[model samples]
Target: MKLRTLLAVFGVALALTGFTLVAAPGLASTITLDEAVLVFVGLLGVLQGVRVAIARSRTAYEQVETPDPEASQDLPTPGDEFDEMLATAGADRREREMRESVRNRLERAAVATIVRTEGCTEAEAKRRLESGEWTDDPYARAFFTGSVEGASLFDRIDLRRDNQSRYHRWAVHAASEITRRSEGFDA
Candidate 1:
């Protein structure tokens, strides 16, 4: 125990002596003590300046921006209005004005599609849509001709508001039918 304690004390003393020799001013290195002090003080001053700048920037950001409320907001796309109505139709479950808007848009879309694909007049397209001759899907035909008022009870029973309404389903079916007809005509 005594020998170990002595060795530890000797090691510490030797380390301190070496440190003193190396840390002494006017040493073997080319950089003098004055130049090292100036460099350290300069680094500290730069760090302090950076801290002050960051603090000032934080306060500057805390102030209110310009008076224009919409300056930071994104602009709506061209089709956003119609898309919002469609989304409302999908979420609300019960059909209302939004559903009507969706139906109206889809009806127009169906007529336009008929006009384009069948190369018929607008009046003939409307007649086709009204007579339920545009597509073979029964639900889609009912959607335009008002043959069926609402879907089955199961289609309207979305209590969680997660699933789309029956009207949305009919819309999707109608759109797919239109797309299919358009593709077939093109082919």
Candidate 2:
């Protein structure tokens, strides 16, 4: 039965029992069977409501209100050691090779970005890129067609004003270079 209905029934039974006990002098002196049952049922309804309230309280407490300790501790920040690794890798590579690799990575990053934004899989994004379906897409056109000249493809893609933003620009530039090289353009 619904909680409200059960509560209403319990209240009515209790009220009737109380009225009966008050009217009868003999019943007022001693607890009757009907009065006992009504009290028990009312207590049970109250207990049920308390139980539901407690359960709901616990569920609310366990919800995503607090930040996860592991998540907060483990996730890399903008100025983390990972940035050093990327810088070292870039520095280690010859200028020509580095440029090509960066271009390839950027292209892949662009595809990944589109896939994430469009809610598509990596495979779908790759197909779109390979098939030239992204020629009309503003992001794709900007990255691929060299539409925005002088600013390096990286700069265009790194719209965010942060450390990772610089990395994004570099990635785009690298990917563009890789694409050009693959198409037999001089490095």
Candidate 3:
């Protein structure tokens, strides 16, 4: 027999032996061997039925339970396509916004140098603006910060180059300016 079946049989035998031992000595009740066997089988059947019923009830209760969507939806579901799509879209939107913000900042920086050279071509002025040489230039940080407007040096470079160069140059210039200002130096 399988281990579980053997265990069940042993359990029943132990239960019958315990009951016989506990019976009162004055009560001379005679149960036939067949009747004792039948009673043990009946008890085993009842125990098995009770176990199955308890298991079925537990399964039914779990199946009927519904979780609140608001509480559960925030967590990522494993292997769920819709959840993955939403997460990807959110990431893409954030990246695009960051790129746009950088472009706007560069444009602002380019517009600030207009006053110094009235007739200067936008291309030449942008080159001058992006070159690392002008990082100390007073208008550089203001350009990125959106404080300066109208014909800044950034307008001189071609729009594409202007964006690339301005992003790099402005970042450096802005950092330096921040450090300078922090130390109470005017930049």
TM-score of each model, in listed order: 0.45, 0.26, 0.23
Higher-TM-score candidate of 1 and 3: 1
For model 2, how does the per-residue alpha-carbon lDDT over 75-122 read when each residue is reduced to its tens digit? 777534534444654555445564455446556765765565556788
Error of 2 at 135 (Å): 10
Misplaced by over 4 Å in model 3 are 1-13, 16-19, 22-29, 60-187
Which window of ten consecutive residues has the lowest lDDT sum in model 2? 178-187
Compared with the true structure, model 1 gives a TM-score of 0.45
- Residue pairs in steric clash, candidate 3? 110-152, 110-154, 111-152, 112-152, 113-152, 114-151, 122-156, 123-156, 126-156, 126-157
Q: Rank the candidates by TM-score, best first.
A: 1, 2, 3
Prediction RMSDs, each to the true structure: 16.0, 15.3, 17.0
Give me the runs in candidate 2 sitting further than 4 Å from their true place: 1-94, 127-140, 147-187
Question: What is the Cα-based lDDT of residue 102 in candidate 2?
Answer: 49
Per-residue lDDT for 14-76 in model 1, tens only? 577458658884453667679867865776566566666766777744566777565576889
Which clashing pairs does model 2 show?
102-174, 102-175, 103-174, 103-175, 104-175, 154-169
Counting only residues 3 or more apart in sequence or on different chains, how many pairs clash (N, Cα, C under 3 Å) in candidate 1? 0
Q: What is the C-alpha lDDT profile of model 3 across 1-187, one tens digit per residue? A: 3447657876887777768757854332566668868977987787677667766777744346677676545865653552343334334545555545554544444434431333456766555555523345444544444443433566544333632334444444454453443454323
Clashes (backbone N, CA, C under 3 Å), per candidate, total 0, 6, 10
lDDT of 3: 0.50
Instruction: Write down the TM-score for model 3.
Output: 0.23
